[model samples]
Target: MANGQEWWRGSVTYQIYPRSFMDADGDGIGDLKGIAQRLDHVASLGVDAIWLSPVFPSPMADMGYDVSDYTDIDPTFGTLEDFDALVDKAHALGLKVIIDQVLSHASDQHPYFTESRQSRDNPKADWFVWADPKPDGTPPNNWLAIFGGSSWEWDARRRQYYFHNFLREQPDWNFHNPEVQDYLLDCVRFWLDRGVDGFRLDTVNFYVHDQLLRDNAANPLPWAQEAVRPFEMQYTLFSKNRPENIAFLERLRALLDEYEGRTMVGEVGDSHHSIDLMGEYTSGSNRLHMAYSFELLGPDFSPKHFRSRIEAFFKGAPDGWPCWAFSNHDVPRHVGRWLEHAGDQEALAKQAAALLLSFEGSICIYQGEELGQVDTVLSFEELTDPEGINFWPEKTGRDGCRTPMIWEANAPNGGFSIANKTWLPVKPPQQARAVSAQGENSVLAFYRAMLALRRAEPDLRLGNTGFVDFPEPVLGFQRGDSLMCIYNLSPEPVTVDLPSRITPVLEQAAEVGDGSLSLGPNGFVIGRLA
Candidate 1:
């Protein structure tokens, strides 16, 4: 393996949502101690690192994304010592620790925000994005919050409207303020000094909003009405993705460079411009190590869609790197999200694992994905996600996938918690696919095998890719010069001719007879060409 300096180039990172992963002290919510206890399980998956979701001090208004204090561990999770212990445990297990850092905004309850909102004349008054209302007493502009409704919240103390991209409790910071930039950088420095490996930057594009305070233009066409949140109805050109963001990234990169083996992967969340932004953010070595967009998280699983996304990114920024993920804490589980295209849940899960691991970039796997766990069905009353609650009945929200991980099928609460109630329910379906119930040839086993294969083959990990011209459902691509990866996106058998000189490398679930490769429904194959 490469030294810590370059270990992240094409590493596999498993994301653990602390609240739902495991609970120590019999608490319903998971904590740092719970994560430390589970390090062996994470290390067993053959993953290079574990990317924990936010565990910093928070009110849980947005489920930890709204951070109040960046330097300390949230009391709900554990003390700072517990976090340091987890890092030690992870490192001893040969697993790197990457944590989510939400710098775009902070909880309104944060002391900085509290002081900033006090009459607007204090030293921290410019810490948050504040603007005066329009002549008619409306919000500063037509900007809308991602959760719903207006993005601006009227503040009684400051008598100004504060900008919040998501929830009102989560206020966006004014990046134009130099002091604000220094504060955020210092917060990151605190974690880097604590032996952290990297950061998964939340809302990376939202760091620097337009200083002009201009109104976001309406969604051009086609996607205008098809949008989910009102925030999606507009292009959001001025509100985010500002040109000034790159400078801040340079500063962030400089900070990371001070550490020996630190890295950063930003989340670019623009609906239309995510791909382009990803290119710009990662093109230069002075910016993020990589950036991941929601391009693959969407429902479009066709060959063309997948091919175009990969090709477009490489074409735009040949020098940049990308981190790809099919599912994370924020979205629906891949099996449940693409259930229609999957003939069998187990088959699809294995194929998805094979496919993602075979891709030519860093990969992230959410906890429970290897167990083939689908989203648990939850009633409205059981929902805890604010987005789901706001769009009730219509959207089930993220709670379905954020349920407690099932470690033991028969154990109460799937052995995730000893408490009578978990933060989210562990249902029968999820319990059935618990780790203890998995056999030698289970989805979990397939993931381990795929990861091992990736580690053994340097070409598959850090290879240059070229798309193969296969039909609609069969997505084929070549990794470097020798390795070829093909996936049948749909639940139907497909056959394609093998390359002139080829030997099947990872064909446990694929069949090859005569001169053609036959893939079963939701099957994938990897071959090495002579």
Candidate 2:
């Protein structure tokens, strides 16, 4: 957490999924002006910065992941003037703006992709990853798409197959080509010139693949199961996480280095070698500033699981900085998913906030987490997520968590939009936890308090953490110099002998006694070492 090395260390970032954050117009889709109007609300949370999901012109194939134009703002989101105003307002509010950069691919409608597919020898023909089909007319390699099925799509116009790790309409870029690299760099420059602080690189490891197109090996783990998609069964070593990606990351980092205090966090999605890859991406000064793994976002919510994940990253890369998040656009909200074991939802939410903030790395708070929002239950007919639509009953898609933010309890569309119908239904339970309802001494209030404490208490922010010996289901760790944090992860109360050097400074739940600690279910305590 050195000051000169990485500016993102110990920073709290709030993620705003633009389409669901707030809608200014009656179109039911959230826009840049809506985000600009809400800047004060985000700043009031005491977060260090805000990370906005894609607002660039897109075909809406994967809901903005399939970008058609890199420089222009989507008309549905806002005009260029609205985006500039948002940048100005965010900076004025002392909040840094980090945009989502999906550089792995572009929409098929993009000029680069359009020209590249027109003919085999077009001027932009080599800008995309195009390969010839095998003798049997199958894909050149055995690469799998994260969405589902094969990674390559047959293009009749080009008489070949093109790589697409996600959606079929989103074509993978040819990062190995220097000209393509320069074009992507210019896109970065376009945003950097507009006063964006940094980027959250999407599918960062998928930037490059084995040029020879080797088949990926079978996953050796017996626990690996084909649950939501068949793509989860095989190891992705050959398809992505190539050795060539690191150099390109360095090149991207060098461009960002020109902007003072700018930072970047890569999304590392590999189940195998995630932490190791995270280390490799963020270890040196020339690579990404931070990277987050899906380890915490996974199903495990036990004390042992949390400890092992954090310790593994700390051990894997001593110099690398990590950013942690329990919930995001992809997964079910932590409150709803962990509710069965976490006891009272309200208390558990505070405990989660405390646990995340106390971790020895940067933290990302998903929108609606402050109010302890849980995933809204959606019927199959109401689901909008493409992945969810493809998976059906086995896995309810991300639409549960991507529901619109609730600002007023009784307002139409929870005040997210004036439209009569929303993209996703905003439930009454979620509406009850609206910002106005919880002005102070609410879950949102507790969030602000926790963030303030993390900011004020130096030991909690950038301190080295070491686990304190404790019985099962009770997690205890001591931050550097002071601050001993303990969490009760079980269904019943647990008592532990307090360290003689420590005294209770903050108790998240009143049922937990002061000084000598006795934690109820889902209880957590923050104490200062004497």
Candidate 3:
């Protein structure tokens, strides 16, 4: 922090899903060359950094989360030289590059996992979580894989079962083993030498396990049918989120400290204790630079829901920092999830973007959010996400939010590719919201203005956030002492008296005169208090 390398603080990072970003070769798949070509567009958005999703060599079992090789780029994405050129292109455009690191698990096809499962006395046997089954011949415990079934997969060679928090093909690593920790840190050092500005650590909270082979206890609270998968029925106490992760995070941080200006934002995946973990993992500046959870990414939309979660995190970890986002590749677009709370599609997009950007800490804008893109509607056959395939109708999976970017409204495949069919079809709805079709008053233009304003004003970017004591349907907060941010989160107009006379700075369906203010549906006011 003393090195003045804290640009990540209060900065905005854009998450790029390379496969869906652009296809330079017209191969119906996006590659590093494609991303390099699109760097100019990303730079135009006023983002400080760009976070690329996993591009490592993989079996694609979990869609790149199942990493088979960590040190090289997957052929589907590109080669090491191509990645280096992409990095160079991004740097030229004044954008920092952040890559994803999935350390908790590796695809079973990885060389290490292949050897570990070959025999009980293999050189890498203890590198993975290997457990002996009971006399009755069942899994060691009730720990379940997040993709759907038992967490343990039997291996006939070792007469034991291996643990997997996600897809069974993705086996969990033995973090208790010192060699495993050393190897992963060395892999990180490999990237540090490659000139990456930072990292977006994936499944960071799942870095360690109980190691006792204990069962996961049932969830104490009654959730009814709201549970998206069977994985939600249990507490995940023994299966993951073990205490040992804190030490490993410290080790990781110390490694990053060696590189000037390197930062990390971990994704905490716990259901019940994610917020507390977000607080713990980021507290004291010795671990993550910032962390984010599903808190703001869900379907809930209200003053209370947003206020309660933001307040809870700061209260628990005063020194810690958090990153906020409204939509991402993993969830349905905010425009569709909160459609009931919105009167106009463009209006809601602008308001939600305003709220996210104005938050206290660093924020992330998922790809296509600035264009006011809505989720793509897909049939069950069109779904590629394993979670959606397993839960079918209950949860349509993440495919809707993960469609390719729409650069042209009328071009084939939404101008993503010239091929007859891309990896995932880009439908008409997404095409209609293309970047080529937008004008100066479009959501994309508003995003550029908002970002420029944040950069020009200090209070909006680095101010201390203090929420006002207002009731539901109305959200008001003070940024520092002079700037006031107010929002009406309902579909109906709500009128209120300002704390003082004010001048409207950024408004959408909002008006301020005298001491009275009128906010229409999804209305917002960022004004200077008089």
When sorted by TM-score, best at the front, the candidate numbers are 1, 3, 2
Residue ranges of candidate 3 with Cα displaced over 4 Å: 1-3, 224-226
Instruction: Please give the ranking of all candidate structures by lDDT, highest first, separated by commas.
Output: 1, 3, 2
TM-score of 3: 0.98
| Candidate 2 minimal-lDDT segment of 10 residues | 507-516
- Per-residue C-alpha lDDT of model 3 across residues 1-530, encoded as one tens digit per residue: 01257888888989999999999878888888988877888899898989999999998988899999989999999899999999998988888999999999999999999999998887899999999998899998998888788989999989999999988999999999999999999999999999999989998999899978788888776882367778888898888788999999999999999999999999987778878999999999789999976799888898888888888898998999898888888889998888899988999999998888888888899999999998888999988899899989988888899999999898999888888789899988889999899898999998998888777667777888899876669998988877889999888998988777778888999988677889999999999877
Candidate 1's TM-score: 0.98
Output the number of the lDDT-best candidate. Answer: 1
Q: Which lDDT values do the candidates have, in the order given?
A: 0.89, 0.88, 0.89
Q: How high is each candidate's TM-score?
A: 0.98, 0.97, 0.98
Q: Output the TM-score of candidate 2.
A: 0.97
For model 3, which pairs clash?
A: none
